[model samples]
Target: MSHDARVFLREFLRDPARVAAVAPSGRRLSQVLAGAVPRRGVALELGPGTGAVTDHIRHREPRRHLAVEVNPRLARLVARQWPDVEVVCADAAELGPVLDAWGAARVDAVVSSLPWALMPEAQQRTIMTAVQAALTDDGCFTTYAYVHALWMPPARRLPRLLRTAFTHVAVSPVVWANVPPAVVYRARAPRRDVRAD
Candidate 1:
């Protein structure tokens, strides 16, 4: 196995629920997720396992690249691999506070590799709420779901939650090159009333 896969597997073995995958995302899925990042402006990444997607995001050269990884080991690995990226060992659900601590007023894009399907509904809502609040008026959020999970309740619930939080949500074509395949969801235009209702 490759170094990235080994590292990812170690983490997965340590905490299956949090790591969610046996290996880091493939190059194709990484490219697709990073596509949402603007060429310039602040960009945030959640759960950058082994920095696979981080490589693609760096190529886009966003003004500021902030990555939040809940795992301390993975966070340190990403930080060492990409010294330029601001790596924070924090929960993605606490995005608002993370951004505030970083002094980022608003982010232009959010590329996430988090396992949304594994999260509870309340946790999903909490993370989405933070994402909606931290985004700029035109900022976009990108994340993926495994193809096999599309019919599952948690997968189905993600789009529903996103629709309620953002004005526009688009799902990309399935990336078959990825392990088990996956589809990326791009959401834009945060709804101001997301918290009111």
Candidate 2:
């Protein structure tokens, strides 16, 4: 679980915007996200710093669990804590090759803990494209953003981007327990017929 806290603390100190939160996500937020998990199948987690949310996700009973952590230290921590999970030290934008390395054609669900508001538009577009391509026919992609930042131009544009990439997107109730609070985004891959348009 990397309960030591130093993992996230060090990362937060290194890059405030990248780390996003000062502390690991609280349990309430984790529960809210874990609840939205697919019934059963391979699930991918992005930026699982310290595996706080990953810990909660483990209980959701996914047949296969994979986590992509850009930081090697944090990735090692997650792998050590969750022996069954496949942890990769690579950028989320490289999901295609990473999934290929994992021998997964597509995943049923994707959960992200990335700081979308802080990313450049180009980087965001790249990662979003990778996410869309990595998902299976019935796959869904999920991520969260702080409620306070919802008004920011970049944050405001996130939902709009999701709508363009997915057939369905919905925002869940705010998890008040999280510092500064946050809301989850639940998005489903566009149906083949819908994508044809």
Clashing pairs in 1: none
Instruction: Indicate the residue-level lDDT of 63 in model 1.
Output: 95
Q: Write down the lDDT that model 1 would get.
A: 0.91
Q: lDDT of candidate 2 vs native?
A: 0.82
* TM of each candidate vs. truth: 0.97, 0.91
lDDT per residue as tens, model 2, 1-197: 45557667788899788788878888988777766567667889999898778988888888999999888888898899899998989988788789899998788888899988888777787788778777886788889999989988778878877887788999988888888699999988654433211
Each candidate: what lDDT?
A: 0.91, 0.82
In model 2, what are the clashing residue pairs, if there are any?
Answer: none
Residues 69-160 of candidate 1: C-alpha lDDT, one tens digit per residue: 99999999999999999999999988888888999968999998888899888889999988888889999999999999888887899999
Runs in model 2 deviating more than 4 A are 1-3, 191-197
- Compared with the true structure, model 2 gives a TM-score of 0.91
